[model samples]
Target: MGDMITTSEQQIPLAKRIRAHIELADPITWISPAMICICGALASGTATGFQWWNGAHWGLILLGALMTGPLGTGFSQSINDYYDREIDAINDPTRPIPAGLVSLNGARANWFFLGFATFLVSLIFKDAMITALAVFGIILSVLYSMPPIKFKKNYLLGPPAVGIGYVTVSWMVGHIIFAPITWQSITVAMINGGLTAGMLVLNDIKSVEGDRQHGLKSLAVAIGVQPALLVAYTIINLCEILFLVLAVMWGNYWVAAFIAFAVIAPIYSQIKLYNDASHKNFMRYLIATNPFVALIQIVSAFLVGGYFG
Candidate 1:
């Protein structure tokens, strides 16, 4: 009984540490990128009348899409954690690296392995577009985190870099996986990119102190949090409004309605952000609205497919 109790005790802390590493890898943030791909797939498939689901390897395609986030975005996140360890020490010591839940070398290994795996998986789909976009995504992820090219240090470029990598690249990869490229796919990618950039800006709201201390010029660090919040809101609201208008133009009332409902959460979060720019409030705003934000791409799928009508 004593031996068993000791083993169980050892496992408990190990499990918690593993959980922390995974959290640092950020699986939750992966959903948006993966869903963005699916959204593009739905839109392109609908427009091109391509039967993506009818293929023998459709399961592989789905797997590839799911892997998009874990391999691409999650890898980028780990690299960011590795590079940002010093900043995290100041702002979020509870993070895996700073807390010693995961070693710096472990994070770097994960980044390289995930990047290679992500690219390898794309080849299984045998689609040139998918491969191209996957390669582009890897490049962008490296540029975002690796030294001397860390776009994350620039307030003007950082958010947009993440947005393009997460939304635009993923979206285009999904679009061309089984369908011909179309203007609809391009437009949707652009819109999602802009909105995702806004979301990245909002993410910076919680990192202002760390960023400023680290000499990182995130928008929130460069400008005051309030103005950064305003810019984020304006960008998000504008893209959403553009999406609504485009949905109406496409006769996608369902999509428009979905977007309108989606807008409510951001509006409320903005109100909360305006009320307080503290990290706690920003975290609250994220928790209150992130799932809703993930659903936006899903709604885009429905919109393009005209599922409501």
Candidate 2:
């Protein structure tokens, strides 16, 4: 809340500026794609391990990570930061753009370059599916961040849009690369999508004040934090419950038990989110806990594959 300048912001070297901009991309956010890779592999009904000595399969994984991380998620984060500069100025002034570490033009150029390079890389794969997914991601990133059609402004559409982009579509891209596309894969993707959307809602709680100031009606801003928290918990718990029930219906009682056990972490996260609505706390909790949550899905997929294989 205070406009105090940190020492890190004082040192304005070229490398530091570049790092600042890259940091804005938030590479740590790649858990979405990572989870997808795992789930897709499991749903593909194939063994998920690869030979580190084999360049072909390993290369595909690396390429997927590059596209999903820098080109896709990076572009989204950069453009979002650009569009949310005003809000950042209020809520997160030390961010790259708001802190004056990167020029607005420089940020725009980053988005353009990443967007093009992602598509170009996808084309190199000579796979229509990959190219389409890449394009879809780019389009979603633009629509989510750009004005007039910035879906991020609408509480109803914003979180779901991101959930679809970050979870379902991203997961499909990873899945299709190594696995046959199937109905089961899509079901997994949708479940992950719902979970991610709920997590996004909790993430938004931290920014309610800034969103309010920016006239953005995020769920937290529109319905109050307590009610928004309830909605988030509902979305998250509902998905997990469905996964558990389906696991039992499929006669995979071990998978159901695993998922039931994994549910505890999210409940703990919700309690933490309820207590500390600060952006810093939410981010810390999310980063620390989201992967574990994703792991439940990943391991559940592992069990599903084992049971059906």
Candidate 3:
């Protein structure tokens, strides 16, 4: 009985411990952020749509996009844990960093490991250009997450860098999806990046307290919560207006209408969400609108791609 009790006690805690590490990833919240990059690649210059139609090239593109996003996300997350070690000890002591499934040195080492993996796959794409961009991504990922250079702590720069960087990186993945890239492909890529950046700024609102605790001056902190959210929605709405107008002009009235409705529904939801804004409510509020904008962009891309393909 004593031996059995000891083994059971040990096993249960280890299982609980593993679950804690998984929770640190915030996987539920991170799903779209990771997949959106893949969708962006599909929308811009689908790996499957390439003329070369070779397995090896498509493998590289697919592997690169997957690594550039989630792996980079993992690195950024590790760094976030490193910087927020103290913060996590306060707000989330059960997390891996605080509970210790990952050591400080281990997190740093893992961050670099993923960062290096990102570079290796990026190098497999369009010569040194893709490789250079990959290097920039790693630098920025570390820069945003680490202390003394943690851009996520900044209001003005953080959101744009994260969002825009995500979009552009995805687009660059698309560029490598094809060889001898063209002007049209690059334009679509930028648009994808721009719209994604817009959504990210809005997301910073929900993280305000956590960011503020760590001296992270996110948009909500820089401009107060309500106004920052208002500005975020305002820009988001404006993008919707532009998208619809351009779609109509190009005779893609269907896309314009779809976007028009998609944008409106979120505005309505946000208006309702703001009225009672508790911490729980604000986190819930974040759920109502953030990913839809990127979803619309990705949807629009597929629509365009299908129309042309």
Candidate 4:
């Protein structure tokens, strides 16, 4: 037992533990939710005609970003890594947990700490609605990864769960920081959720092998890869087109024009992905095209907030 403990300590050396903890939190995945949170703030600030130049206002916006990004998202990712460690062992052995860089107990502690921090920070906003939304976000994040109700096990439920958590909830939190959420904000946020769901469909492709082994019905595992790609790209493109139509109908021709232009590259990449449908191609497509997806969301937020205001 003493030798085993020594080996374990050697596996996760003390000096490298901080970096391992960060890796377990998966900071790279925080970008989308963080940016969307900021977009929510922008939309609310615009719609409410709030003073955008106020330093306090900007500070609040940054705080919301922190909740969604590092605190909330960090909680989500850490918990997910804990629950999905078995899957990760098969799919990505290099991950901190599977790589033995972080012990399972350490991972559990990390997520619990993050979840508690997220809750505490939400209270700092001093709004019941914001606090409620924050609680809901935490619950959703837990449901997405934890047992029995692990939403990620069901192809139909999983992607949308993530979308709502990562995009819609984050947006709502940001919006509520500055103003009450309106129908327009809710609608646009849900639209972004749909877009995220579509992207997540493609994301499942990389994990198909492990998903199949674990009986997780991810889109790529349930449907053939090529067909899943088609479905994903269709959902993505349709969401964009819907947003474009909404912009035009709202008489935001500049936004519409920008959306139209922004979509071309992604569409081109989609065609390439559709033809090949390999994991490498999927990564390339996401890296090359997802920026436009983000740009569209930001532009759509401005359109909705400006016109509706």
Highest TM-score model number: 4
> lDDT tens digits, residues 75-159, model 1?
8888888888888889988877777666655566778888888888888878877888889888898888878879999978888
Clashes of 4: 0
State in Å the error of residue 63, model 1.
1.8
Clashing pairs in 2: none
lDDT of 4 by residue, 1-309 (tens): 011111363555677988888888899988989899888877775536335778888888888888899989999999998888888889999888877788777888899998899889999999998888778888999999998899999989999999999999998988888888888889889999999999999889888999999888898888788899988988888888888888888888878787777667677677888898777778889987688898888887777668443
lDDT of 2 by residue, 1-309 (tens): 222234354468878977987877877776566556546555555465333355786677677767776678888888888888889999989888777787776777887887888898888668899899889988998899888889998888899988888878776776677765777668878888888898898888877889998888899899899899889888887888888887888788877787787676556656776787776667766775667667766765665455353
| Rank by TM-score (best first) | 4, 2, 1, 3
Candidate 2 least-lDDT 10 residues: 1-10
Off by over 4 Å in 2: 1-12, 47-55, 265-291, 303-309
In lDDT terms, how accurate is model 2? 0.76
Location of the lowest summed lDDT over 10 successive residues in candidate 3: 1-10
TM-score of each: 0.86, 0.87, 0.80, 0.94
Q: What is the C-alpha lDDT of each candidate?
A: 0.77, 0.76, 0.62, 0.84
Local lDDT at 104 for model 3? 54
Supply the TM-score for candidate 2.
0.87
Greater lDDT among 2 and 3 belongs to: 2
